[model samples]
Target: MKLSPRMQFLVRNGLKGFLWLTVLLAAYFLFREVVITHKPDAWVERFYARPMIIYLIYCFSEFFFGLIPPELFMIWAINKGDTWHYLFNLSLFAGISYLMGYINFLIGGFFYKNETFTNLKRRLLKDSASQVKKYGIFLIIVAALTPLPWSGVSLLVGSAGYPSKRFLKYALFRLLRFAVYGYIVYQTHQI
Candidate 1:
């Protein structure tokens, strides 16, 4: 079967968009060393030991996204003290993750919008943006729950200037993943 001229144009445009998105994702990993590494200071470690501050610190850590497994943070929170402590940990993480995601949202919206990847980015986000629009929340939850390199996706969406309401909706879905995983950690602690 042969594609008409119009079909060809669409195919070419879609291919260009796919390639650009791949490159954008790859580029994020290329700088993963700088982009993903987090070294907690001695003071921070000491601070977590205080029991009262563990929940607050764990939330802040999620803002880094790919820096570490969220399970580790959950485990730390579960280790705190009582049911109130667990709820506190959940709240802390939620606040931090939301704020952290916003930073990436802005980074996508602003910092990476250079001539370096201009055409490709425009093609991917602009042309293929609809593909995500339908299942945005599902995707965000998956990204938050799994160990995938989802921060890049968040950044791309942000860069493309996806509406803030859409972004928050997705972030809330992702937060559920974190909370579910935290529950898992808490259960494992009992046995």
Candidate 2:
């Protein structure tokens, strides 16, 4: 017997769902084992507990954005405590990162309005324009996922006069990327 296209699509998605569930379960077991066997690092907790240090790290890291992978901070947060703290750190990092990206977008807009910077912007972002056109918002999500310089992409898209609403809408995926990557890193990172 043959299945309809819709049925085939559903079956494929169902299988994918099951596979993900299995992988997640295995990861949970591994994480639990690690937590049980390893003692939490006192210095890591001390460093994480310092609000001034965390603020400095957040500012500097956000300034460096793509240059400095945010995973280091994410790992630090995961080491801070349990799942709730990990999730809080994910949201914190994502919010700060998104704010920086928005600031970069505003800077891009400023460059767009200036003739000298506008020419330079065109030269630098010429290729990205085509890529953005081809892939639309998915390109932004891909950049975010790969831990690439999403601020750069944000700047380029903003300078190109991509609709502000659409840019904001698509950029929200940065939060999801942070959450997903934070979870994986939390589960796998040795305490």
RMSD (Cα, Å) of model 2: 7.8
Score candidate 1 by lDDT. Answer: 0.60
Q: Give residue 15's error in model 1 in angstroms.
A: 25
Q: Candidate 2, residues 1-191: lDDT per residue as tens digits? A: 99865555445554654465466557656865687347556455667679568757776767565655676677677777788878887888899888887787777677668899768857776786565555546555655555556788777766666667777788887888787877778778756
The models' CA-based lDDT, in order, is: 0.60, 0.69
Give the poorly placed runs of model 1, Cα more than 4 Å off. 1-61, 112-138
Worst 10 residues of 2 by lDDT: 9-18
TM accuracy, model 2: 0.66
Cand. 1 TM to true fold: 0.58
Model 2 ranges with Cα > 4 A deviation: 1-46, 121-136, 189-191
Clash list (residue pairs), candidate 1: 108-159
Per-residue lDDT of candidate 1, residues 1-191 (tens digit): 99865555445554654465466546645544463335435434665568646544554455555565555566556655677777777667656766777677777777446665567766655665564554445445555545543466677566655777778776776577667767766777763
Clashes per model (N, Cα, C within 3 A): 1, 0
